[model samples]
Every structure is written in C-alpha cells, then in structure tokens.
Target: MKKSLIAVNSVAGAALLTLVAGAAILLVLMFSTDGDADADRRAFFGSLMFSTKEQADGSTAITAGVDDPVPLIVLFVVLAIALTFIQLTYRALKVHRQRLLEERGLA
Candidate 1:
C-alpha cells in the first residue's frame, strides 16, 4: 500500500514539475522581446493592468490592478511552506509506521 502510494506520489510530482516548467518556459517566451523595444515595453506594461490605454501626453492610463504582484508572491510562499509541511509529515508517518511494524513483528 505504502509503496503504491509512493509511486503514485512520485508520478504526480513529476507531472506537476513538468507542467510548471512548461508554464515557466511559455512565460519566458511570451515575455521575451529579442531586442525589440516596443515589444519589451508592451510586455512590461501589459502584465500590470487589466486594461490600458495610451494618452497623448505620454502617460499610462491604468484601468485596474496596478502593482498587484505582492499578493501573488505571498500566496506562492505560503503554498511552498504548506507543501513542505505536508511532505515532512508524510515522511515522519512512514517512519513511525515502519517502527510500529518492526515492534510488532509484522515486517
């Protein structure tokens, strides 16, 4: 049972890692400008707003959600901590189960 669970978890983790890597690569590709200043400026400014328009006075007009990356960063940190805790708890439980089986002559 435990071995099967470990195998499943390993597969799932690998899949998730691959998905994240692909997403990161896609993001990099999307944001890469290849020395195009206009595209670089567009990519830099576009990620910050839901809607945007250029004014004749050379100023940005932001519609919503300007500079909102802090919350997203915080969420990722919390998620990483939670996953670490879960993995540690799983490892501890596996060790404890092994100790119990050994004491009871079941393994």
Candidate 2:
C-alpha cells in the first residue's frame, strides 16, 4: 500500500512537472514577438517582464511582473510544492545512505 502510494505520487509529480513546463512554454510563446506588428499584443506579456509608459506630465511610469498576478501566484505555488518534495527526497536518500553505511560499520 505504501509503495503504491509512493509510485502514484511520483507519477503525479512527473505529470505536474510536465504540465508546468507546458504552461511555461505557452506563456513564452504567447509573449513571443514576430515583428513590429506584435508590439500592441506584447503589452501584457511585456508587463510580465517590464514596461515603461510615459505619463501626461512627461514622467515615466515603470512597472514589472503580471498585473493580474494570479498566473504568477499559481506558478510560484506549484514550484514551491515541487521544491519541497525534491528537498524531502534528497534528505531521505542521504539518511538512508548513512544508515546503510553505519549498518556495515563503514561509518
């Protein structure tokens, strides 16, 4: 039961990683600029990175990151969870390796 649960989790994690990668690729492609014709469409995607718009007073209003922010927030949440599991896996392997070495009186 425990083994099956682990197997399922591993598969789920892999699927999620693939999903995230696809999402990232889609975001990039959406932001891609072909030429000057895409300048208008690039506003939103550009804002995800950076932008500087001139104000009425001849001052520049600089901004960065997504204005909606939901996408960015969701992306961070997914990455954080993936990182947590990665760290847990690394620690577990290290501990298991140390335990095995100690068992054989090698450490």
Candidate 3:
C-alpha cells in the first residue's frame, strides 16, 4: 500500500513539475516584449500607474487597477506553496512507512 502510494505520488509530482515548467515558459513568453530592451527594463523598474492620461487642458487623470498582478499572482504563489507542502508531507509519510517496514523486518 505504501509503495503504491509512493509510486502514485512520484507520477503525480512529475506531471505537476512538467505542468509548472510549461506554465512558467508560457508566462515568460507572455511577458516578453517585441525586442525592446529599454521597455523591458522600464517595466520591472517601477510600480507606476498605467491608467493615467494627459488631457488637452494640461491635466492628468488616474484610475485604479490597470495592469495589476498582485491579486492574480498572489493566488498562484499561494497555491504553489500549498502544493509544495502537500508533496513534502507525502514524501515524509512514505519515508516513515518505509522505515517502519524496515524496522519490522518486512523488507
């Protein structure tokens, strides 16, 4: 039973790793600009608001939540941490079971 669980976990972990790698690649591609080095540098350089526009009367307007990623990336980061904790717990339990079997002389 323990061995089968470990096998299943290994398979699941591998699949998850692959999925994460693919998602990371996709994210990188998504954020990539059109061969503009200055733009790329400026993007991560500051947290300026993007909803501002200059009016013909020499005034500035600012709204909210334009290109905001905190609400989105926070979800991904929390879920990733949850998955890491679960995988670690699964591996720890598998090792504990193996040790128990070993101590019992059950191979």
Best by lDDT: 2
The lDDT per prediction is 0.52, 0.57, 0.51
Candidate 3 segments exceeding 4 Å error: 1-67
Residue-level lDDT tens digits of model 3 in 48-105: 1223445678765543321444533444455555666677787899889999999999
Question: What is residue 44's positional error in candidate 3, in angstroms?
Answer: 24
Would you list the clashing residue pairs of candidate 2?
none
lDDT of 1 by residue, 1-107 (tens): 76566555655665565446445544654445343222322222233333345667876554433244554444445555555567768899999999999999998
Q: Candidate 1: list runs displaced more than 4 Å.
A: 1-49, 52-66
User: lDDT per residue, candidate 2, 1-101, as tens digits?
Assistant: 65456556655665576456545644664556443231223232332543445667876564444445555446556665675577568769999999999
TM-score, cand. 1 vs. native? 0.43
Clash totals for all candidate models: 0, 0, 0
TM-score of each: 0.43, 0.47, 0.39
Best candidate (score: TM-score):
2
